[model samples]
Target: MRLEHDLAVRREARDIIADDVAIGVGDGWQHLVGRALVTIRDVTDGKVNARQIKERQGLLSIFTDIMIRGSETIAQRVFDVTNGAADQSAWVCEMCGCGGRLIAGNRLRVRCQVCEADEPERERVWREHRDDILEAAATYIRVCLEHSRLFPVYNIVIRVCLDDRDHRLFLDEVHDRLVWWRAGSWIEGVEDALRQDFRRLDFAR
Candidate 1:
């Protein structure tokens, strides 16, 4: 969900959700989650505790471990409500909350017709421009590493010995880029390209 929406739900259901718990969902299921939390709260009379709220296998997954001041029947009802909400999310778009269908493949996603339709074009564009995007990423990372401006946030794993000089330099450069910097106007363009590349790359599988 969006930060604002997440914050709103957290604020509204302060007593039910843990402080560190993250609602791992998109804007589309905001109401479903909000309603579920509210219903759970009302049903348990402000005595339930939710430890996790996330999307699991393209469906809503809410994990609640405690319900104080509730009978066995009430507890069962709570479970039914949570499960029902999760099941309902199967048809709800995770991005826009519109009616959606689960797209089964390498990764599961619940997306509406519009969002699903856009995926192919995104993948097509990424595939056509793959080399350019990769070169930009490499240039950005190399520049950042050489100038000690910043480190790459994403990478492919490397198998290097602990005492390798190249590995040590890579680690040192990575550590130095943790702080904010005026990386450059070019940084924005490179970052945007990299984001698009990374997002569309998942569809290739």
Candidate 2:
């Protein structure tokens, strides 16, 4: 996606302010202005981590009732930064294979109007197509990983358990590989138990 015009303008303003601060345009305000400029720059450049950017942007104040608000606050920021140019349409319907006329009305739900014409059939098809469900799950997981910028180790773990139950041995092997590469630890045994339980299920076979 192209950078938003408003964001570009704000970044330019930040740079100008930073330059002024460097040349002693405002002695006492230098530090505050400089830090603010840096924060803006980092956020615009996608360099600031989510937590840091959230704190800097004061997102907490704008969002109370975290459970209820969902990602609306962040979505609005993204929209604003992109000058309302982000395509908010659902790329594909999880329920049906239909592509167009999918409305993103709620955070959790994406409904395709054409598919809604026969809800029973859509649900039946979705339930019957195990491979399609697995493919969708894998695609969703991949998109999430990419958006979150997750580590390769986590990606491997997620990939191995994408459409299946967690496996301890599988997870342990992933961890071992990471360790061999001198990566950080981030394993949870509960995931392995879940995998084992899933593996034993007849339906999963």
Candidate 3:
């Protein structure tokens, strides 16, 4: 993030966050966090309290956890905003906050080099294999993938558990992305042939 843009974000955050959040790491994720803070302030009618403390910069996106101080309804709204912030990071560069895409592999990463000039050698070991589905429910599915030490940058585990309507909406977004990544980008139709048992999970139904 440029100095000017970074300063601008701080000003924006200062206005909305006001005296509620004392400390935050609003770096690299200025816009996403800024938007969430604005929403949090607006929806809660300035009754919410929150502060971002960490940034989980993943291969596909960035994530952050906030210390939220509010009622249950306010807490739920914070979660929604946080998730939205992370999801929006999928296409935004973790370095410069520009448009970017995932660079998957044994060491999954993203294409921030397009803007920031830092490109690592691509090593794709995402292959046709199956791991035990440790748990699967109507709203979420989990399969063991490479551990964090091995694939530190990639989001090896994705658990999308939401309400029925939100679940479908979220899965629909994942489906569309898979059509591009699983079908077009990475393993051709192999995700379909390989993870065939995935349908049995019945997360959508």
* TM-score to true structure, per model: 0.56, 0.22, 0.42
Q: Model 2 off-target regions past 4 Å?
A: 1-43, 48-79, 82-87, 90-119, 129-205
Q: What is the lDDT of residue 132 in candidate 3?
A: 13
Decoy 1 TM-score against native = 0.56
Candidate with top lDDT is 1
What are the per-residue Cα lDDT tens digits for candidate 1 across 56-171?
Answer: 98898888865555789878978998999988999999877899999997778899997676556545545554444444445545554445443233342242324454343333
What lDDT, from 0 to 1, does candidate 1 have?
A: 0.61
Residue 133, candidate 1: Cα error in Å is 16
For model 3, what is the alpha-carbon lDDT of residue 89?
67
- In model 2, how large is the Cα lDDT of residue 68? 34
Each model's Cα RMSD: 14.4, 18.0, 17.1
List the candidates ranked by TM-score, beginning with the highest. 1, 3, 2
Q: Residue 168 lDDT in model 2?
A: 27
User: Please, what are the lDDT tens digits per residue for candidate 2 over residues 136-168?
Assistant: 333433443345432333333344333432332
Q: Candidate 3's residue-wise lDDT over 22-54, tens digit each?
A: 223323456776677677667767665454323
